[model samples]
Target: MVWKPDWVASKDILRRMGWSVVETTMMNSNPPEIEVPLGNFVKMNILFWNCRGALNVDFKRRIFEMVINHHPSIMVITETRVGGDRAARIIEDLPFDGSIVTETIGYAGSLWLLWKTDDVDVMLLSSFEQEIHATVKVHNSDPIWLISTIYARPRLSERRILWDSLKAVAQLHNLPWLMLGDFNEVLSSEDKFGGNQVSLNRTLQFKECSDVCNMLDLGFTGSKYTWTNRRPIFDLILERIDRYFANPSWRILFPEAAMTHLPRTCSNHCPILVELLGSTPPGPNKPFCFHTMWLLHPGFPNIVQEAWTEDGDLQGAILEFVSKAKHWNYNVFGNLFAKKKRVLARINGAQKSLASRPSEFLLTLEKQLIEEYFFNFTPGRGILGTEVKIECSYVWRP
Candidate 1:
């Protein structure tokens, strides 16, 4: 039989899980500003994805989620399989301000650069069968970057042609240059696992290509391997075919840049993120908010009554109320935000545990915590959004 639970039961379940629904806050009397939006400026996130032509309905949604979560300034995609009329639609769905795409020849391979729609002035220098070369200047920052993305031809002879052409392209401009994509080759043996040993001759060719281009290996931080054959463990193959390489000038421009291989949940190849951090300027202070959720507790009224006794005037009374409200919250509530953090941590632990042993009880607990997390994601919504219609009822004594 399926189990159903109401909010009351869910609350009891949460309490049993060690996180009570009636959480309180130990707030500051001076009302410290909310420390949100840790980063002041929007740093550039460069993402390269070899999607391998799986542009299902969820494909676009997944892309949107990645974009929203990481806010990449420049996004590069390969093997999109979308062509002609459909390519435009795909670009439209991207959160980035604009994009440039390479031609798709019968759904074989395609390359494109997507950038923030505004303050992005990029000129397409050249486009080829295997690559697209462009110069990008964000907000006239003077540190212009020449970017080239390649989806190399699978054949060895054809790859030689691509390497030679790329060598010529790299020397075309003296600016900071970044080269990235699915080269379909490995530079080192460590790049492959569960596969036949990579040939010395193949690695030599790839190394020689990098030498000719003066490209620095912007090594990755996440999964050691970026591509998998999707076969069973015994017959499985994994290799780091996708890579990000840049010239010395590029490193000089963004010294703290890093590339991380994000987990591959739905694709053969994992998407790599190249983070180019920028100077973060100071942001303005956040305004104070009055949380009506506090009022739900019986002590809230007592604290307000004690703090609201008229001072010299209305302004003084309000000042006193604000001061005591903060003090009372600190003394009485015992840190509400900390409670949220603990609840989220418990939820994470429950999720990991459920993976090993699935149970209806754990599922219900996870669902409850998820709801709790969302509520905390947007604090004090009880008094914020119009969804909460507040009504004041008057009791008449006759």
Candidate 2:
């Protein structure tokens, strides 16, 4: 239980403000003494991949690469195309300590939910041919959430069954629910390229199901397309069928949760890594520096006005305003630094895609992101820095 002087002061302040603090054990500490809010202190990584087939000779190596790089507490591999003793043997050699397997239907959809028992407790709730639902409780944490790993069947008729099953599961409990996998269906035309346009009729069922379940798409960080058909330039087909969706409850639980589309290797579908960072170590405390961007928020004036008191204690009023303004900036206007990081990530992903394929859509997206970065981060600068333009690629200088 390492306690800093500042943390001690914070604990006293929180207790005085009627906030409950608990000495919960975190993954980083052996016998935890850190006092945090009375809730889950989760900070774990999850990796989901549609491995297409897991029987290849180098499959174990690929899994090792992902595990070594991401160190995920939970991992889901869909479309294994293997079952029975063969599947068990494959999982046996993997890095995780616990595992659950949903056998394939004659070389079709299968799901392997693997987890580190040392880091998390996963209770198998339901397992179907196309999906595996589990209650995940991070070790030494009070939060318990439901996680569903799905692999919707390739055919439209079969996918309807998957959607219906999910709806039924969604009704079981109102816990923070997270569903992720290869849906084998696109939600919009923007989710695909070099293929027949995705018609509304094709997307209507999935959209309806999502709306009924109140699911929000947890946007990804890397290339928009997650799967590709390995073909020549003229016939190449790409689609972002694999994704993560969470209910509003789950989003509120982990607002900083983000998913990254990893580079495609050993499979057509790119691996998606989801990060839930809840118990990260606090940074150094610095004097408050007012941000110019807060002026852009419509609610800033209201927050200042509310913080101002009728009493003639100028020091107290200034302190109150600072506290209220910081809270508003966080909960309403959002953390500008975090937003800037996401924007830069999107820009990097777009630039990478353009470097490989040079698509008009990606080029335009990169240009827009560049303008946003310059306008928000650079003081006294125009949106495009200085006359930004896109020829075959984006050209900008600050």
lDDT of each: 0.66, 0.73
Worst-scoring 10-residue span by lDDT in model 1: 383-392
Instruction: Please give the lDDT score at residue 49 for candidate 1.
Output: 90
Error of 2 at 83 (Å): 1.1
Q: Give each model a TM-score.
A: 0.61, 0.63
C-alpha lDDT (0 to 100) for residue 381 of candidate 2? 51
Top-lDDT candidate index = 2
- lDDT by residue for model 2 (233-283), tens: 466688889999998777877788888887564577889999887224445
Evaluated at residue 121, the lDDT of candidate 2 is: 91
The all-Cα superposition gives candidate 1 an RMSD in Å to the true structure of 20.9
lDDT of 1 by residue, 1-398 (tens): 11122334434443443322111111213222322111123267788899887376446655764664455778888988776667887788667667788888776887777888575666666677788777777674655567888899788997888888877654433456899999999998877766688989988988998998899998876667777675644555778899999987777677778887765544678888887873244357322324445666578777667655544555555556666766876686555545654765676565444434446575567567756655554335422110121211221111
CA deviation > 4 Å runs, candidate 1 = 1-42, 278-398
Q: Count of backbone clashes for each model? A: 5, 0
